[model samples]
Target: MSDGTGAPVLLRTDGRAAHLVLNRPRALNALNHEMVLRLGEALTVWESDPAVETVVLTGAGERGLCAGGDIRVVHADARDGDGSASAAFWRDEYRLNARIARYPKPYVAVMDGIVMGGGVGVSAHGDVRIVTERSVIAMPETGIGFVPDVGGTHLLSRAPGELGTHLALTGARIGAADALLCGLADHYIPSAALPDLLADLAALPVADAVARHARPAPGGDLAAAREWIDACYRADTVEEIVRRLLDHGDPAAKEAAETLLAKSPTAVKATLAAMRRARALGSLEAVLDQEYRSSLAGLGTHDLVEGIRAQVVDKDRAPRWSPATLAEVTDADVERYFARLGARELGLAGETGEPGAPGAAD
Candidate 1:
């Protein structure tokens, strides 16, 4: 039975599996507050439903599962309105990410294509994550002058070697194999096999359904490049990291250096700090709390609005970052992003001190 509510998200049940479909194909299923609330409600219901043995998440369109949150709203609020609305939305959305992380039933995520930012939040944390040949996963918030949120810092911090740092500062996209190597996804199932696999999920156990479709992802760039990625990104500061990348003699490393130069200096610096702190914070909830602070801090910056204007609004492809270069981003500037939100805190990590993924060797 399908929950035909004519909403941006669609809910349905088939055999023992319940599906949560992101339905806004026109916006590439960019999640809004309403969809987040609906998803939370659906998950709450299905968590206790005796017949639902598996919960599957998929996007409605051919493009991908989800792009991310509705950032246009964030851009608007930051530009014209008080920051409260954006903060409220993030509060609920981050809570949903934590819920999905701890969801007890088999939570299966179909990560087929174009998943980034909030999309990574909803899918990467699931117990059963399936990526396809078409899958392109990233945490690309820095490009728009926002640090990665929704436990993205936590996930990225746990990737192999300095892979997390490399991705955090550069906003690099990875394919299925790299996603697997970085621990962002569990299996690689071809796009062609997805329909049949989804149908099998309706009647079979998640492990069984996935096993029938899973295959080795043939190509990945990260493993071969780990030496330079780890060495270059391990520096204490972004500027030092850039110098290493430029001097490393690999064309790819130089390209990464150029990529870093192009991002908002403030955002890239804050992200590096966030990723490092996330490694020590010791849990997803803690990292999310930190990211929330970074996000709200971003609301007060000129670069956040300007970066969005250049990249998304005006389509100019050239963002004039405040403070301009990595050298101008001071320690105080980066530290301010980690300031406490106090009463506005997400508070997901009650009593704190849960374990984190051990620091990857850099």
Candidate 2:
């Protein structure tokens, strides 16, 4: 089965298992509006089907399972002066994330390559997350002038210690080992073994198949730097965190400080606060609600526009962020990102057939 448009998403079934392949290899399988809706619909259909014991998701190409959401469309939407397109995209995308998190059956995500931003939203929430040695994961949104969304706060917050804080603020990419260390992935399988693993999944129990294929992951950089990360990123404010990093004088600390400084000040502050608040929240739904509010707030800000312009449009690599300095973004400004959206807030309830199904908000 394919969702038309040259089958941006393709589905194949074997016995009790359904395999989903993201088919836009040219785009690195970046999720677009149509792809998001199609994926959600398929997941919803399989959710209640007794014959479908498991769902396996992977990208078509070797480059990545997904790079992220189609940010170019987002840039176009932002430039078009109506936030409707971006709004619709996020509303559906987030609901998909929620559905995956609450999915009844075993949902297996093969994080094979460059998974970041919206890609993480899809894979991280699955029941069984498989990462290969080639896997590269991150939430590199801050560099693009947006705070991480799609329930990123929930996933990042749950990472051990202050590692989530460090990753969120710096948008650092982590390998399979680090991804495992951060609780984002469950099994580590060598890329060469994935074919046999999938075949086993079709014949054996999902858990048994995974256990049979899983291999020991290499050491992660995050584990060795846990103390340093915890010490620097534990500060209440981004400025204080930077100060600590710079003062620490270690090469890694200085590099981290430089990375944070290059990001949008507004986004950095907002992301730091979101990660902090997410730690206190109990559920993924609650975290998504908060993330929705922050995303909406960001749509009205200048940083997102400038950030995309610098990073994507002009490829300038230098964004003129509003409130360019950390000191200029006061506490109240950061608080505004978390403000209640009231009636306009996301409605995350319901499953496939009920009210608030995927794309209902649009």
Candidate 3:
């Protein structure tokens, strides 16, 4: 079916296996409202279909599985001071994230290339996450003056050591091996072999098909830098983390410090808090509820607009962040992001309170 943007997200079935391809190669298969809705609808149908025992998700071209949600649309909504569209998109996208996390049937995702922001949301929660040498995974919302959403708080909260904190704060891109080490990806298969792997998946058991093609991912920088990452990111706040990184006097630490300094101070602080709070939450639904609140709060801020303008629209690579420094982002400001929305709250569990069910508010 068409993803409502002329680009079609092709869906096909072969015996007990179903394949869903994100089909906007030119745009790197970036998700739009129609794609999100269609994907959720498809998953809901396939979940109960006895003929569909497994689902394989991938992007159409070699560029990537998905770059992210159509942020340009978000930029327009926020610019026009009408967030209705943005809110609707996020609500449905987040629900899809919850459904993927709870999917009963085996769900395999081929994170072959660039996967960032909303792309990470879709693939990271799958039952089997396969990355390749070309895979470049990151949660880059902070760079756009937004904290990681789409249940990113929960995913990052569970990463090994303080690597989650490091990733959330710096928006660092990681390779296949690092993805495996951080629990983000399960297997590493070469991109070329993906076609054969998909063929096997259609003909064999899910586990056996994957086992036949999965191979060891090459070593990456994250493993060697884990000690430093934990050391620098374990601090109580973004400022303290920067201090630790600077004091370490190493190239990686210095680069990380600069990256953190470049993001919106409010986003950095709020994301740090979200990751910490998510650690205590027991469910993905709870994490998404918190994210919904945070996203609304972000929409109320000026930094998101400026950040997107500078980074995506203008390509200036320089954003004039309000409350430019971490010191200027008061604790109260950060706390406001986590506040419950009362009547406007997101309901991932639906009216029946069944998690991953389809009756949620849009």
Compose the digit string of candidate 3's lDDT tens values, residues 113-200.
9999899999999999999999999999999899999888888889889998999988999999999988999999998898899999
Candidate 3 is scored at a TM of 0.95
**Local distance difference test scores for all models:** 0.90, 0.87, 0.88
Instruction: Report each candidate's C-alpha RMSD, comma-separated, in the order given.
Output: 3.7, 3.9, 3.2
Cα lDDT for residue 301, candidate 3: 86
The residue pairs found clashing in candidate 2 are: none
Residue 292 lDDT (model 3): 90
Worst 10 residues of 2 by lDDT: 350-359
Taking all chains together, the TM-score of candidate 2 against the true structure is 0.94
| Pairs of residues at least 3 apart in sequence or in different chains that clash in candidate 3 | none
Off by over 4 Å in 1: 1-5, 351-362
Estimate the lDDT of model 3: 0.88
TM-scores of the candidates in the order shown? 0.96, 0.94, 0.95
Candidate closer to the true structure by TM-score (higher is better), 2 or 3: 3
Q: Model 1 — TM-score against the truth?
A: 0.96
Tens-place lDDT digits, model 1, residues 1-362: 11243688899999999999998887888889989999999999999999998999999879999999988899999999999999999989998998999999999999998898899999999999999999999988889998999899999999999999999888999999999999999999999999999999999999999999999997999999999999999999888999999999999999999999999999999999999998888778878877888899999898999888998899999988998988898999988998776667666775344432122111
